[model samples]
Target: MPHPCALDPEQVVEHEYVGLLDPELRERIELWEEELLDAEDASAGPGNYDSYEEYEAAMGGGGPEGDELTYQHDLSIAPGWKVGGFASRHLTDPAPVVCSCGAGMRPLLTVHGREWDSGTLNWVPLEDLDVLRLPGANVPAGVYLGRGLMCVFVCPADPAHPHRLSFQ
Candidate 1:
């Protein structure tokens, strides 16, 4: 995939045939699918791994805390376990999960969109953001934020831009 053509925001084309995906992103996504497919066995059973080495490999080795990914820019939205998907916010951004400390946990997609504007949780790369088939959708697993928050879908003028929601 090619980087979004700097000259025109609407350059290239739509998904499938579009060349607007960022080069790094296209590459990383390609790699992630590979990793996901190669997900290895843990050391013990269920959630436990064979050893520290196996554990790290299974979870892709994280920081000193062992978090799979870094948590930043926490926001406030649906907290606790989310039962149903948020009605219309999935397209913009998932409701942010705020920690008791004041900072809101970043949206899961923001974390997925590593190059996101952490402050705003807006994905710098456009392709990975919410995409729709024009009208409505139904995500059975409960379309939600990573930490498990409700989500709603929104449609922007340019589908590439981050969708906005009334909630945080």
Candidate 2:
């Protein structure tokens, strides 16, 4: 057997990492990508002519209704996913939390979630969102505006994973 302190002759030194990422982080990222790809592939239909970018855009409501969808926050996505929307750190009661970056947090004007397991759909107004925190979301992720509604993006852990806090 080789000596405990001595290195194996064929072992690599592990001196070079592509960046700050360690193997575990890399593995998580890979796994997440794999899940996203699988989910996308399975959901895609022949001659659908829709792309994820288009889907993402539609999900954000940037497109007119009836266009290719980006997937609604209440449909294929989980809760707490951050989406592009108007946000401000300072706010009124129940929320008004401070961001880790020291920016004030805004309220979630709106929210959505799809429970694929139960085939349930959800769409909450701003008043109710003062509580729920979804995954992989930043503080801005939770904040919403305009009739107190915000779009829900899928948790980054996996496109199909359960909702997480959007804002940190």
TM-score of 1: 0.18
lDDT of each: 0.33, 0.34
Worst 10 residues of 2 by lDDT: 6-15
44 Cα displacement, candidate 2 (Å): 1.6
What is the per-residue lDDT of model 1 for residues 1-168, given as tens digits with 9 covering 90 to 100?
Answer: 222322212222112211234677667655765564445333224766667787666554533323322112122222222223222243344344344443533322211112222233222235424532222112222234443333333332333434432332
Tens digit of per-residue lDDT, candidate 2, span 53-142:
775543443233322322222232233322333322112222433444445443333242221112222433243345334532122333
Stretches of candidate 1 off by over 4 Å are 1-54, 63-165
- Per-residue lDDT, model 1, residue 168, is 27
Clashes of 2: 21
Best-fitting candidate, measured by TM-score?
A: 2
